[model samples]
Target: MALTIKEENQFKYIDEGAGEVLLLLHGLFGALSNWEGVVNHFKSNYRVVIPLLPIYDMPLKKAGLDGLNSFVEDFVKLKALNQMTLIGNSLGGHVGLIYTLNNPDKVKNLVLTGSSGLFENSMGGSFPKRGSYEYIKERVAYTFYDPETATKELVDEVFETTKSIPKCLRIVAIAKSAQRHNMAKEIPKIQHPTLLVWGLNDTITPPLVGHEFNKLIPNSELHFIDKCCHAPMMERPEKFNKILSEFLETRPNDS
Candidate 1:
C-alpha cells in the first residue's frame, strides 16, 4: 500500500489505523519504507506511526542521536502520542533508548532490532564511499545475510543519498555520535518491558550486542533470527513481525 504521509509544521510522518500506537523509528540510512512491513501488519489492530527522522536534512551540528531523540519527542507531543509501543531499528533504536530514558512514562513497551546504543561496526567498518555504485551496493547488501535482498532500487536510493557531500557529512557525524554515546549504564534503569530482536548473522551490531542489551535492560528479552543480518524487518519481515506480535500480546500487565 502507498502510505500517506501527514505533514505538520516541520514534521512529516505516516499515521495509520487506530487503537494502540506503534511509533516506529528508522536507522541512519533508513526511510519510512524501512518499516513498511511492520506498519502494514499492525495497522489493522494498532495505530502504526512512523516519523521521518531528519538524518540527511538536520543541521550538521545537531546530526546525532540526541538530535534525533529531540525530534521524536517534539513529534510525539505534536501528535499527542502516549503509551506507545516504541519500536526502533539501528540508529533509530539508539534514539528510542534516549527518548524512553527521559520519558519513561510515555512509553508502555520498547522494541529494538539491531539497535546501536552500545557498539556498532558502522557500514562494515567504514563510512560511505561516494561515486562508487559497486561500493554502495556491496555495503547495502552487507546489511542482510542474503545479498539478493539488496535490490537494485534500494541500492540506487542509497547511492543517490551518498552522492551529495552534505548528506555524507551529516551521516558520518550522526554515526560517530552514536558510537560515542553508549547507554550501558542508562539502559538498566529502563523499567519498561523491552524486546530485543536481533539477526544471528548480523555483522554490524552483531549478536553480542543483542545479548548485551538483554543483560543491561532490567525487563527485556532477546530473540535472534537465523540467516539474517542488520535489518531483520526488511530481510526477514515475517519472523520480525511474528516475534513483535507475540511480545505485544503476551506483554505483562501493568500493576
Candidate 2:
C-alpha cells in the first residue's frame, strides 16, 4: 500500500493507523520507504509514524545528530505523542538515543537497529563519491549481506543525492558528527526497556557494536539476524518485524 504523506505545520510524515504509537526514525541516507514493511505490518494494531528527516536541507552547522533530535522533539510535541515506542536505524538511532536521554518520560520503550552512537564505519569507509554511479552502487550494495538487495532503483536514488554538492556536504558533516559524539557514558542511564536488533553480517556498525550496546544499556536485549547487514528492516523485514512484535508485546500496560 502506498502510504500517504501528511503535512502539518513544518512537518511532513507518514502517520498510519491508531492506538499505541510507534515512531520510526531513519538513517542519514534513509527515506520513509525504509519503514514501509514496518508500517504495513503494524498499522492494523498500532500507529506507525515515519518522519522525513531534513538531512539534506537542515542548516550546515546543525547538520548532525543533535539537530535531528531537536527536530524529532518538536515533531513529537506538535503531534502530542506520548508513551510511545521510539524505533530508530543508523543515525536515526543515534538521534533517538539523545532524545530519549533528554526526554525519558516521553519514551516508554526504545528500539535500535544497526545504530551508530558508539561507532560506525560510515558509508562503507569514506564519504560519498560524487559523479560516480558505480562507486555509489558498490557502496549501497555493501550495506546488505546480499548484494542483490541493492536494487538499481535504490542505487539510482543514492547516486542522485550524492550528485549534489550541498547534499554531499551535509551528509559528510552528519556522518562526522555521529562519529565524534559517542554515547558510551550516557546510554547506561537510559531506564526505558530497550531492544537492539542487529545484523550478524553488518559491516558498518558490526556485531561487536550490538554487543557493546547491550552491555552499556542497563535494560536492553540484543538480537542478531543471520545473513543480514546494516538495514535489517529493509533486507530482512519478516525477521525484524517478528522480533519487534515479540518485544512490543512484552511492554507492560500503561497504568
Candidate 3:
C-alpha cells in the first residue's frame, strides 16, 4: 500500500518492487496514472518507476527536450538507477531515445511506443485551443483506436488539467522542441537492444515512422498492434504486456 501511492513532485514518480528496474515514461498530456496499470503489472517482479512527465497543467516546470532529458539524467543519478529497461510512450519515447543514445551503458533495453524522435509529426490540426469538454474530447479521440475510450470523465479530467495559460505555454514550448528533434541520423549509433511497438492506426506518429525506427536502430525489433492508435499500452494492454515482458526478459544477444 505504501509503495502504491506516489510522493509528489512536478516530476512526481511512483517507485515500487525489486529486481531489475523498469522505468516508464508516459506520452505527452499524460500523468503517472497513464502507466499505473502497466506499473502494477510489473511491480511484483521489477522495480517499476513511472514519472509524471511535464504536462500543460503542471505548474512552473518549463518544457523542452533538453530540460526533460536533464531531469531524467539527474533522476537516474539521484536514484542510483543502473542498467534500466526504459519504456516510454510518444513524447516520453522521444525523451527516452535521446537519453539512451547519450548514455547507452546505463540502459539494458529500450522500448518505445509510437515514439516521436525518428520523424517530424504535424498532428496539431486536430486539437482545439481552449479547455472545454468537447475540445478535450476531440483531442483525446485522436490518441486511441476507439473513440469511446475518451469518455466524458476523461474529457472533464483533461479539461480541468489544462485550464492554465502558463501550462499551455509550456505545452507549446514542448511541441516546438519536439519538432526540432531529428534523431534519425543518430539512431544507428545506439547499440542497446530496442523494441519499437507502434499502433497500426496511429495517426499521431503513424506506422511509417515505426518502420523508419526499425530500419535505423540495429539490434532492434518492431511490433505493430493492429487496430490500435497512439497508445498500445492503454488500448491493448494484454498484448502490449506480453511483448514487453518477452523483450525485457531476454538477454541482448539471446536467440
Instruction: State the C-alpha lDDT per candidate.
Output: 0.92, 0.93, 0.80
Q: Backbone collision count in every prediction?
A: 0, 0, 0
Q: Candidate 1 has which clashing residue pairs, if any?
A: none
Quote the lDDT for 251 in model 2.
90
Give the higher-TM-score candidate: 1 or 3.
Answer: 1
By lDDT, rank the candidates, best first: 2, 1, 3
Error of 1 at 69 (Å): 0.8
lDDT tens digits, residue span 80-147, model 1: 99899999999999999999999998999999999999999887224646889999999889888999
The TM-score, computed over Cα atoms with residue i paired to residue i, of candidate 1 is: 0.96
TM-score of each: 0.96, 0.97, 0.90
Q: Ten-residue segment with the worst summed lDDT in candidate 2?
A: 121-130
Candidate 3 lDDT tens digits, 75-192: 7887888889999998899999989988888898999998889664544322346667666778788788999877777778767766766666777778777888778888899888
**Residue 99 lDDT in model 1?**
97
For TM-score, the strongest prediction is 2
Error of 1 at 62 (Å): 1.1
Model 3 Cα shift for residue 179 (angstroms): 0.9
